[model samples]
Target: MTTPSQDRPTPQDRPTPQDRLTPDELRTLFLFEALSPEQLDWLAERGRVERREAGEVVYREGEPATCFFILLSGALSLNRVLHGDDVEVTRTDQRGVYSGATRAYLGDRVEQLYPHTLRAVSDAEFFVLPADEFAYAVRTWFPMALHLLEGLFFGTRAANAIVNERERLLALASLSAGLTHELNNPAAAALRATAGLRGRVTGMRHKLAMIADGRLDGAGLHRLVALQDDAVQRAATGVSMTAMETADAEDTVSDWLDERGLAGAWDLAPSLVAAGIGVSWLADAARTVGAEHFEAAVRWITYTIDTELMMGEIDDSVERISELVGAARQYSQLDRTPLQIVDVHDLLDATLTMLQARIPDGVRVVREYDRDLPSIPAYGAELNQVWTNLIVNALDAMPDGGTLTLRTWREDDRLMVEIADTGVGIAKDVRPRIFEPFFTTKQVGEGTGLGLDISYRIVVNKHHGDLRVTSRPGDTRFQVCLPIEQTAEATETAESGETTEAGGAAEASEDG
Candidate 1:
C-alpha cells in the first residue's frame, strides 16, 4: 500500500500541460484568459495537483504559503480564525478561481498578510500555481485581470458608502437631539399654563352656577356680576383694572404679588389708585358678594393672572419667531442684489442686530466706524452673509463671554473691516483648514462647516476682496478689505465715453 505522500505526484515528476495546446490556441487563450503556451508549459512542469478529502484542511491558519492554489473541482472554503471563532470569508467551487491571482495586486502589503486558512468541504482537486507565476499570468491577461479588479473596486466602494451613510445618520440624530432640547422649554411652559387656565375657568363656572341658583340676593348678585365684568375687561385690555375694578383687582393682585414677594407691586399701586380704584370698592364688593362670590372673584382674578402670563409667553413666542425669520433673512441675504452700493457699517449693524440673541449675557460689542468711508460697490447680501458668519463664530468661541470689537477704516482708498474677538483662539494646526469647505472644529451638529467657506467666497470672489485671519490663543481677528474704486478698465471706459461725447459736440459746432 502506498502512503498518501507517495501517491501524490511531486512538482518535478509532473507532465507539462503547456505542450498540449498549439500556438494559435495559446494566443487566443492569452487574450481571453492570460494563459500562454510557454507559461502553461512552465506551470504544467512545476505545478502540483493536490486532492483534499472531505473534512480535510488544505492549509492551516498561520502556515507559510509555498504556492497559490485554484479550485479545479468540488468546493473549497476560506476562513479566518478571529478571536477563537472560525469566520468563513468565502467559498469557491468548480469554474471559480482562487490563488495569488486574486491578491497579486496587493502583494506584500500589510493588509494582504498570509495563510488565510483553506479547507475542502468535499473531495476536491486544486491546481497549485506559484505566486510569481500567478502574478505574471494576471499581468499578461488583461481581460481576466480587469474582471477581477472590477469586483474588488465595487466591493470597496460599497463598503465606503455604508460607512458614509452611518456617519450621516449619526449627524442627523445629533441635530434632532439639539432641536428637541431647544424646543422643550417653551413647549413645557405653555402646556403647564394651559392646564392651570383650565382649572381656573372651571372654578369660575362653579361660582356662576351658585349665583344663578338665587342663593345670593340682589346686592350680592350685582356685586358678583360686576366682578365678572371687571375681570373680562382686565383680561382683554391687559391693564390690571379700571378705577372701580382697581379696588377689586388691587386686593387680588396685591395679595398675589406679596405672596410671590415681587418687587414694584407698590410702584404699580399708585398708578392703579390714580386710575380711580380705591380700597372701598374691593371691600364693599367682597362684603355684598359673600364668601362664595368672593371665591368666584378670586377665580376670575386667577384667570386674569394666568391669561396675562400666557399672553406674555405668546408675545415671547412671537419675538422668537421674528428672530428666526430675521436670522434666516440675514443668512440668505434676501432682497439684496449681487452687486450694489452698500454701507459696510449698516450691513455690520444689521447683522449684529440679528445675532443679538446669540451674544453672551455679559458680553458687550464696541464698534469703531470710519464715518467718511465711501459706499462700496459689492454684493450686499453676500457681504452680509460674511458678516453674520464671522460674528456668530466669534460669539461661539467666547463661551465665558468677552467683548467683541468691530473696526472699520480706509487703507489707501480700500475699505477694511476688522472683527476681533476676545475668545479662546484657534489652535495652530486648525487655523490652516478653517476656511476649507466642510472643515470644522465645532462639535458635530453644532455647525455645518460651510460658514467660513461661503464667507470666503463672498469676500474674495464675489466682491473682489481679501479675507484674512490673525490669531493667538485668546485673541483672533478677521480682516476683510475691499477696493473702493472700480477697476482701471472700468474707469478708462467712463473717461473714453466722456471724451467721445465732447468730441462729437465740437465737430457738430464746426459743421454749423
Candidate 2:
C-alpha cells in the first residue's frame, strides 16, 4: 500500500477542474464505498477528474505532494531510482488505488515529497483532490484511524533512530577493543626496552673503565677501539642467516672462544652470531686487542653490542607504535573532514590494520586492490566502517582458519569492493533473510544483525550504490559497488558536509 503525504500548502487560488465526478460516481470506488453519503459528497465536490495518454508522465518522485490521486481508469507504474537507474517497483490498474497525498493526515510532519515516480502505462484517468483538502477529509472523517496511523508512523521512526544509534555504538566498541589490543604489545615492548637500556648504559661505563684505564699501551688501546668499532658495525648489519646457519655460526664462535682460553665467553656467542659475527671476526678482535687485553676488550665490546641491541629494540618498538597510531587515525578519520575524496585502498588497509589483533593466525588476508582505481568522493569514516563490517564478517565465517580476500576493481561507472572468505557458506534456506534487521544465524547476543541492513542503507540509500553477494561451500564474496561519479543531489550533500545514514552489513542485497 502507498503511504500518504500530509502536506501543508498555504491557501491560494487553484485552477478549476474541467470535469468533476458526482458523489454517486465517487461511491463506486472502494475507498469511498464505506463513507457516508455526506462524506462522499464532500470528496466529490473537492476532487477533479484528470486524464493522461499512454506512456505519459503522471508524477515524478521528490516533487511536492500538492494533490492526492485515485486511479479511475488505465494503469500506472511506480519506480524509484537506484544505482543511477530507474527501477520499477510496482504497477497497478485497480480502480480504488491511491498515491501522492495518501499521507495527508500526517499534515506538515514531513516534507510532502512523492517517494516514487508514477508513469502511465496506458490511458489513465485520476480523481485528484488538493493535498490540504485530502488531509482535512482524513483527519475530520477518520479521527480515530488518523491517530492510530500517527502512532504507528512516529513509533517506527523512534525505533529506527534507537536502532541506528545502537548499531553505531556496537560497531565502535568492537573496533576500539581490537585497536587497543593491537596497540598494547608495541607499547609494552618499548617500555621494557627503555628499562633495559638504562641498566646497559650504566654497566657499559664500568666495562669501558676496566678496558680504558691502565690495562693497555697507547697502540693497544687504539687497537681495542678499532675492534669495538668493528663489532658495532657488524651489529648494524642485520643477520640474514637461516636458523640452521645461525646455530652453526654460534657453535663455531663458541668453540673458537673456548680454544682461545676465553672459556667464559659462551654467553656472548648468540648475540655476536646474531650480529653477523663468526670465528673470523673474533680472531681479528683477538689479534688486534693482544692477548693481555683481549678478555677485557671482549667484555667491553659485548657491553656495546648489548646497548646497541637494546636501542634497536626500542627504535623498532616505537616505530611499531607509531604505525599503529597512524592506522588508528586513518581508520577513525577523526582528524580529517568527514566528506572528501578518498582512495578505497587506504580505507581498506586502515581497517585491516585496526582489526589485525582480532584476526586469527590461521586466517590469512589477501588484498587484491586495483591501485589504478581513482579516488572517489565519500564519507571516509563511514566507508571505513563498511570495510570493517565486511572484513569482520569474513573473518568470523572462517572458524578453523581460511583465506580472506579483499578485491577492488572498476565496473563501468562504478567501483566495486569485494570481501570474500573461504569458510562454511551461508545456507540457501537462510540467505534471503540475511539482510533483514535483527536477522542472524548467530546465537543471541553475538550479533545485532543490523550490519547488512545498515550497510544497505548507507550504500544504496545514502550513497546511491549497490551491494551483491555470491556464496558456495568454500568461498563467499560480498561485492559493494559505488558510483564512480556522484549524483547531483549527492554531490551537493557532500559539498555541504551533510550526513544521513551509515554503513551496515547483514546479508547480500536483492541486486545479487
Which is the leading candidate under lDDT? 2
TM-scores of the candidates in the order shown: 0.42, 0.86
Rate residue 275 of model 2 by lDDT.
75
Residues 59-104, model 2: lDDT tens digits: 8877987888888999888777777888786787877687775666
Model 2 regions more than 4 Å off = 1-33, 48-50, 70-75, 91-97, 122-127, 429-432, 491-512
RMSD (Cα, Å) of candidate 2?
Answer: 5.4
The positional error of residue 147 in candidate 2, measured at the CA in angstroms, is: 2.4
Report the error of model 1 at residue 341, Å: 7.3
